[model samples]
Target: MVKKVIRIILLNIFSLFPLDSRKIIFESNSEIKDNSKALFLKILDLGVNSKYKIIWPVENPKECKDAFKEYKNVSFVKKSKSGSSSLLFLYHCCTAKYCFYTHNPLGQRTREGQRKVFLTHGTPIKDTRGMFWPPYENTDIISTSEFAAYLRCKTFGGGDDVVRLLGFPRNDFLFKTDKGTEEYFDKIKKSKFIIWLPTFKRHNISVKRRDFDEDKNSDISILSPGFMEKLNNYLKAKDILLLIKYHPSQNLDYVSLKSYSNIITLTNDQLEKNNVDLYSLMGKSDALITDFSSVYIDYLLVNKPIGFELGDYKSYKNGRGFIVDNPLDFMPGEKIKSPGDLYTFIDNIFSGVDKYEEERIKLRNKMHKYVDGDSSERVLRYFELIN
Candidate 1:
């Protein structure tokens, strides 16, 4: 109570100084990935950097600096729990004209003349339990469509006015062609590639993390003793490759994913270093494999085949819970519940059989209003930053 009052006093005092109209601040949970990096890249591409100054706050400066060494336009401030840097981050928040963030930047509400956009990490189907919402006043939350807007508001706890149907900037990569991105993944694009994304059971982070009673490890049933080896051989035979990018919060001990020629693993570090976004690869990939991840929601726009593995569906539903009683019924993809089902999904991809094309398109139409890839632009124009 005392700290909150003091922080509010500080913010009001800091607000005495005129906020810069062209100044924008971005903070992300993934340091420098998610919608923050996507919107940043789009801003650069649109030549908006020349007009507006961008400040990206991260938990680790040294590592992020080295990872994004190529860029010289934006400034990075060390965002942390406590220290001089934390105070500095708060200072930027009060003074900046615009704030874009994945996580809630608390301590103060949006000041007069200051705008905040919660470019949420994903379109969640999971029900709200431990979710934290940004201050409602002078804030806009990103969503996909009318249905998705309702879900965003429902899951995140905000009014309909607080949630906007403006698509995610990250999903913009799906609709457009980037020559640089294509050239960067030139080798990986040779064979049929399917990206498998599994949602983390437990989010291992201090800021805004929730713990579930999740002992569901697929390594036993899905990835048993010789699972990768067999899956690798099967993919190699079909001249297909599997690209796996696990959730940043999911704790794992990676040993030798490189041993399998048909399998490749991607990290935020690799993507950050290359200045590439995951959605860029998803746009060109043959298919997507996921389990209760909202990546498939955005991938719906690409109209590509998607496969869902529900081996731990019951366990997850009991733990995290979801918006609907039957999430599987709503899914527009191959229902892979076991190894045999997964193999069938792979075979479907190999033979160009999109079993859920009609369902996917229907759901895509229901989930997204704008499929033109202009979300970042819409956001910029919404704030009158760009004409």
Candidate 2:
């Protein structure tokens, strides 16, 4: 309680100084990258002739220094836990006229004159905690689709006016292409590529044991003994590359799988090092394999084949229940429970016998109202309205 009072007092003291109307702060997943980063880059590339400055707080400023060095309007500051640096970070947050973030801001509230936009990380599929609670008091605007906005308001108890029907700004890249993206695509397009993205299960003894057991035989783990051999042999024969991008929460040691030439583990550092965006990777891939991850929803915009490896569906549902009425009906891809089924489904997809194509399109249309790549423009226009 004393610390809270001190923070409030400090914020009040900070507010007495002039705020920079030309400054905009951004954060995504509390990291230097994600949906928020994607949108920020798009806005910068659009050459929106605005004089506003971008303040990005990152753990490792060096990681982003090279990428953003050319931008005269952007600044990268080192984020600290507690100290003078922390106070400087707080001052920047308090003084910025516009703040765009994926998650809730830390130790800060929306001032009366500032605009706080919530660019949510992804669409919610599970019954997340606080989904039914009131929206954060600091969030002045939320960027989401019409359908998602309706669901959020009804389920999460947020006001309708705050919801923006403009599609997610991060998805704007899916509809457009560039030289860099094309080069990245060319490098990976040599062989048929499939990306397997799975949601993170909590780290508990039960979940760890389940993961270990499943890793031995389930489709979730590409390193399973016999399953790995079959998968590698099939990939080698078909000239296919299997790219596994685990959730940030998962602690699986993907480096050990490097021995298999056909199987590659994609880490966040690898993506950053290659200057590849997640959405771009998804767009370039031939097929996607995931289990209860909202990534599939985003991949639907690409109109590609998708497969669900729901080996622990029962356990996952029991642990983190779905918000939808029937989770099975919500999926728009082929559901595979075991490695054998996954292999068969991959063969069918590669042979041009995708049975779920129509269902996938329908789901895409139902979920996304706008398929165009102008979501970032819409967000910028909103900023203009209030500015």
Candidate 3:
């Protein structure tokens, strides 16, 4: 309607500027971080020559200034503003030779010759409802595997040719380590670390329902006082540490779990301050525990033990229908419904008893075509081919 007409008008107007053949833009999670950031850093480190300039946009310039201050070819632009920043964003969108994004572009359509590459945040484990909608239709290239490409085309209405077999750039670090990431591992290497990541359930809950405790319905309740105390006692005895990475949409009161010596909650501010990303944490962890999150699929690359807590599977599946026929069939871990069951499974995993390792390896091979550390190189080569 009117917005579409306005967008077309703006795009056409912005096209009057001369295109910068050597300019490239990168974005992740609507911020300057994610898969796109990881890829950009790798490309920067390769010293791929000085012809190309990299433009990154962030909601707050000061927050990320330190992180990018050392790079000579990189420029940070504010994402929101009344005048200059907005105009700069528009100009970059309209004139940049290539744009790599984890999500869709913010505003303005891609000019005729410009390329838009979608480096998806994670592999598909749940139904992505709006992926087939208008915003994603203009993606010229999408990074995914043959198996995942088929599923994306079938579920998200994209063509097969747009799918590139290059593995996710963020996952590249999972196979190798460097001085930068070794510090993060050293902090937790003393104890066996297990990360519990659960999908968001706010959309399925009504705000007007006073009786519903959203935290209880999701897997966050595993950190309840009683259960955490019991889990902490067992973990301390076994020298195991449990880390909870909550979904961005879930707002849980972490005060209860803060007192436990063995339980730690990873906060967004902490992650930003330390310059650590989710995939890096996943790579360093000994095991993963999740329910309906695509993180487990990525963790499969590490070939570690995984546990599932599907206490609310029926409600979630009914409320948000799945793209797969039977979600349970795709899971490569034990399904534990209660806290006791979860603890018992973890105890077994710690005691050198893993029945699901074979199944996990099989699923990992099926989902990811390449496990080498050259996914970033593949993406850079693809850009070279098109350029």
In model 2, pairs of residues that clash are none
User: Model 3 TM-score?
Assistant: 0.88
Candidate 2 Cα misplacement greater than 4 A, ranges: 1-5, 80-85, 106-110, 131-134, 141-143, 177-184, 203-223, 253-259, 385-387
How well does candidate 1 match the true structure in TM-score terms?
0.89
> All candidates' TM-scores?
0.89, 0.87, 0.88
Sorting all predicted structures by TM-score, with the top scorer first, yields: 1, 3, 2
Best by lDDT: 1
Model 1 per-residue lDDT at 83: 28
- For candidate 2, write residues 1-387 as lDDT tens digits: 876778678888787767788888887644666667766877678754247788887776676777778777887777742322456667777888888877656324647677777777677676665533256644544545676666556556666777777778778777766666577667765368888887765432224423222333233443466667778888888788788876766555432334367777776767766767777777778899988887787788888888888877876676657777788887878888877788887787668777888999888887787877778777778778323
Q: Which ten-residue region of model 1 has the weakest summed lDDT?
A: 211-220
lDDT of each: 0.75, 0.70, 0.70
Instruction: Put down candidate 1 lDDT per residue, 62-148, tens digits, no spaces.
Output: 776775566656677787634234566677888888888876552247477777778888877888644675336437777888888
Pitting candidate 1 against candidate 3, the one with the higher TM-score is: 1
Q: What are the per-residue Cα lDDT tens digits for candidate 3 across 134-205?
A: 434445555456777676666656656667788888887777666545776577654588888876555222
